[model samples]
Target: MQNTSHLLMIRPVKFSFNEQTAVNNAFQQNDTNNNVAEMAAREFDAFAQKLQANGVDVTIVEDTPEPYTPDSIFPNNWISFHEDGNIILYPMFAVNRRAERKPHVLKAIEKKFRIQNKIDLTALEANHQFLEGTGSMVLDRDHKIAYACLSPRTHMSALNNFAEKTGFTTVAFHANDRNGLPIYHTNVMMCVADQFVVVCMESITDENEKKLVRDAIHKTDKSIILISFHQMEHFAGNMLQVQNNRGEKLLIMSTQAYESLTADQIKILENYNRIIHSSLNTIETNGGGSARCMLAEVFLPVQQTQ
Candidate 1:
């Protein structure tokens, strides 16, 4: 239940470095490449093509040029699709990111999927509290548990609201990078797969919270594949496990993230699912998000046709 064959991705129109997100997101860097937009678009197309070749149903949505939303490539942060016929819109911390949530995107998807209700949490942004969708919390759908790390972009108020509405229990923790700064997003520090969990245990500075997270994952019937802070820095923990059309499991990540994994770790992951990777240096450097962020899994039921 954690993986879905349908993925939603927004093609970048003005994919450039976002200064607002860079304030706390340590993963972002200044744009060094000249043709970043062209390079990122090519990378996005190639990534989507690779996923399609492997049997994943990808929905590509073209971003508008007039609004100039630089971080539009990471659509998973603003919205999430649920198997319970629900579409949740989250509160974004960055002002520009608010524009990334468009009604047309939902309308386009509603043609194929049956959405019963919409949960709009965007109003929380007025209170300066935010939870950037799946970026802030990693949900174990099968277990009905939500794992979240406290950060500027992730607030407990929004998290509690989500939990209350979705009937999901929360396991909150404080996580930091090697520099002792708060980890901007929970997905960047850990990922919950169907059969296994890829996480940087070193990121949790609190021993009690670390034990809590470990206990929760252990209780969920998943094998733990631990990565180091160094590997996490390279986005190794940002992987997502998804199923192809044939119901085969595929662990998806960027080439840089895949290369950062140790042989033992790779072997462990490969034991559960086939590894799929694509080159995303241009996107990673500027967007500060990799394979997982680009994908918003669609778990809603398909509308039956006559």
Candidate 2:
């Protein structure tokens, strides 16, 4: 299956704008208007409930309160599950984010799912190299391609290693924020769906790189939904497609992202799937990650019925 109905989300016990992550992620700010941790917990709880109400099977886990890892709610950045029964654990740039990769979580998941192989890329962090999982690279599963934009948090070496291990082609490009600094995460500017790709092509200043990325998407027979740098900044491209309980396709995004869409864009997307969104103002304001970043799809098949 290209998408999963099952999703894993962490309820933030201590969520806030991580000062450590803000070094690379300029989108985050330490502000009092959004009382950091309290607001995040409320938003996360609402977001999870919204997903579940939409018929999504969400596995909610409470984040440990002691360590105070603010970004723990966005679990997709730390781990990903594959259909081949493989699980890949990624190296996180933030010190607290590294703590999000707990063995107990995987063990808990193992009780319901079969994990054939486990690949750990956190070792790269020891060498000062990092790749923040789905945040760093958008995977085109059917085509076996990993679309990534080189940034401070996304290391090229780690991307290459992932490509080699997964037998995926890497389409790496440089993307910058409005101020021209490298964007912290690729998912913030792009998303790869089964038959479509939404991206901020303008972020790639290099003509050659932009063309290469465009050509790669075209080669996959996927329709390109282009979003301007301005739209991308509003988290328009940061969307995820998932299956609902009735086996229906649903595209999930933040309410901010939904409002940013044009009538034509919404119509085009609706042709592919149902759209589901929720108000994540506090989460987006503090965490600098939207709905897509919070979900880690479990593509592994369920155990057979007796």
Report, for every candidate in turn, its global Cα lDDT versus the true structure: 0.93, 0.87
User: Per-residue CA lDDT of candidate 2, range 239-296, in tens?
Assistant: 9999889998999999999999999999999999999988888888778889999999
What tens digits encode model 1's per-residue C-alpha lDDT throughout 1-306? 889999999999889999989999999998878899999999999999999999999989999886779989999999999999999999999999999987778888988889999999999999998999999999999989999999999999999999999999999999999999999999998999998899999899899999999999999889888999998889898888999999999999999999999899889999999999999999999888898999999999998998
Model 1: CA > 4 A from native: none
Give the 10-residue window scoring lowest on summed lDDT in candidate 2.
27-36
Provide the lDDT at 87 for model 1: 92
The per-residue C-alpha lDDT of model 1 at residue 248 equals: 97
lDDT of 1: 0.93
Q: What's the CA error at residue 256 for candidate 2, in Å?
A: 0.6
Off by over 4 Å in 2: 304-306
